[model samples]
Target: MTFENTKEFAQQLDSQDKLNKYRDEFIFPKVNGEKVIYFTGNSLGLQPKRTKAYVDEVMDDWANLAVEGHFYAEKPWWDYHERFAKPLSKIVGALPSEVTVMNTLTVNLHLLMVSFYRPTKSRYKIICEEKAFPSDQYMFQSQVHFHGYKTEDAIVEIKRREGEHNIRLEDVLAKIAEVGDELALVLIGGVNYYTGQVFDMKTITAAGHDAGAIVGWDLAHAAGNIKLELHDWNADFAAWCSYKYMNSGPGNASGCFVHEKHHNNPDLPRFAGWWGHNKERRFKMEPTFDPVQGADGWQISNLPILSLAPYLASVEMFEEIGMDALIEKRDRITAYLEFILQEIDKEVDSTFEIITPADPSERGCQLSVLLHGEGRSLFDYLMENGVITDWREPNVIRLAPVPLYCSFEDMYDFGQILKAGILR
Candidate 1:
């Protein structure tokens, strides 16, 4: 599709967009009584208009039903998190029994590590990308430390080749093999946080398996942004927060996926809680811990109804449109954003290069642009001018054209704002 750097063209595109009507479902922030062109869904999603009603439903159940709400509320609070199984499994491309909504992302990561990252004395090394999200870095460090190993020796970080913005798949696969017998696990971000590079998870999973290693992913950015097939990929485990593309709310409950192969394995180590106990025998309060059948076995505590409510509210919309449709719109809208940025760079004398991959399959909705000279002011200029793109350290500004909320007209407005920013 040919894109024009004009509001008329953008408006025309928006007019034809199949997902355009869904934008009304969100409540956007305003600047000086005007709605800003929000492009930060990769950081925190906009509040769904229906979120309040969903939360209120839970509140109302609590208000009248009290303790009885656990079993008797319209949507029982006892199995509140269970509601996410079907929608989330569909979203992540896993079987319903393989998925469960639970604690925050990092906590789930640690829990999954407890079960999947079994580093024996002979093979205790873990391979991951350099500059992973700080939470993941910390988790890896602590987990290594807990096992009486040093981070420098036990954690193998794969850096981007010198002068390159993203790690090559070949380099990643080679590193997995190079680690060889010492490699115990391969954990990586599904979509890299800083560069928005979507890794080939299926191939990576295969490589890790061939090298005699378990594999997992921190899907914080990839979960709702890109298409994923966790089950087909045969990933050992994965975790993701709902706050970003999932648009559940700030610091919302996260979801986890575990392959069915691990479900019945009583020998697998995990931190247990009552919620993970078998429902039939949970009320018996027996001394022996009877674990649930599948991914539900990994839960460490009762579900947070309030937090999960917003997720339900957001995912219901996902259920309506479906991920295939969302991805179709995602690729086109992101391409439009990339095109606008490239056009702006051509017209401007200053240096502006996209750090994200050029191939549509290699990225999601995000485009990370590196601004060479006089860039900090330009980032500030965008923020002050009612454009809501996010800035990373050094000189990169991240803009995500979210399919469910952002429109093509907003992309045009962003290009115009960026041009003015460079000049001013």
Candidate 2:
């Protein structure tokens, strides 16, 4: 908790990091055969070394017994996905019955929207932060249009002042107040992808509920990045992809949450599949659409074991280190990075601003850097030097040294590389 300069800070912080051992579990990205400092878990997480073995277990099951693999595999590919529920539930702070791993992010979003985004005459509007992930924007538009409403009229996008990065909590509540009776659904990212701001979900959900609106969160960046208490927050529903912070590999399956109170909604119209049918009667195919309780009821397709396995492995790591230690490490490393970036800006004549919140509690691991005139060149230079960060459009570079794998030495080295690049 105490330190000198960045190097001393990093060294002392690393020494104190309870989750430091988790860094060895992953296969960091290699560029030209060198392990690059991967500060882009906001974009994609490093692959856990156990991923192959996990995949092989499923593979062996399929090879040894085709249909029998369903119930007889090593982990039993049939209920294999369910094995992840307990751990995943802990990661996102939901009950096992309220979480399910299935489908891609946008698809799951649409499915959850089907259940949660009920729009009636006087109460037919959706509230979200402006410039939400393009996928969410598209899904909202298509969902509204499908229901015979123009998206522009039905959607309200909350934005920041000129040149600002995050949407303020007060602004969010004020907008909900303005929308009042008309706001039927409030869907926003728990952590904004670009700014790395972790929205106050408890407050947001409370305000939405007070306004008589259903609240949902897109935890694409928040899940596994920060500690969440979705159930306690009384959030109506939420969904997240597993590839980035969850380390589930690219295009991995997504997870969803529907509160236990809404899980038995016999009246909620949903785009259902047989997979969403009552688990006991699923194979019977007796035809009644009895949905499983909680978030599992929102599932629409069979579990993809291959993709889900990587997530399972990562969640296993999460269970070992726990979210508390993970978040502590994350905040320290991110602060180090932010300090170094600011230091670099001080030494230079150019303008580079950190758009992410200065408070660690307000963010996850990510820091969004807004560069001025030389942003692009600085980005290219860093990339060419094997400093792996992500560039969001219009002059913002996003960096996230995930606590599970990124090293303090890694952050220090990244700072050095970044400084050298920007100074030149």
Error of 1 at 189 (Å): 0.3
The segments of candidate 2 whose C-alpha lies over 4 angstroms from its true place after superposition are: 6-9
Per-candidate TM vs. native? 0.99, 0.96
Residue lDDT tens for model 2, 1-424: 4433467667777787777777777887677788898888888888889888988887887888988988887787767778878988899999988888888888888988887888898899999998899998999999999988998899999999787778999999999999999999999999999888999999999999999999999999999989899999999888899899988898888888888888766898898887778888899986678887767767767778878788888888788777888887788878877777776677776478888999777998888888887657888998888888888788989989888888787777787887788767
What lDDT is reached at residue 143 by model 2?
Answer: 91
Task: Evaluate model 2: give its TM-score.
Answer: 0.96
Question: Over the stretch 308-390, how does candidate 1's per-residue lDDT look in tens digits?
Answer: 89999988889999999999999999999988988988888747889999999999989999988855788889988899889
Model 1 steric clash pairs: none
State the weakest 10-residue window (summed lDDT) of model 1.
Answer: 371-380
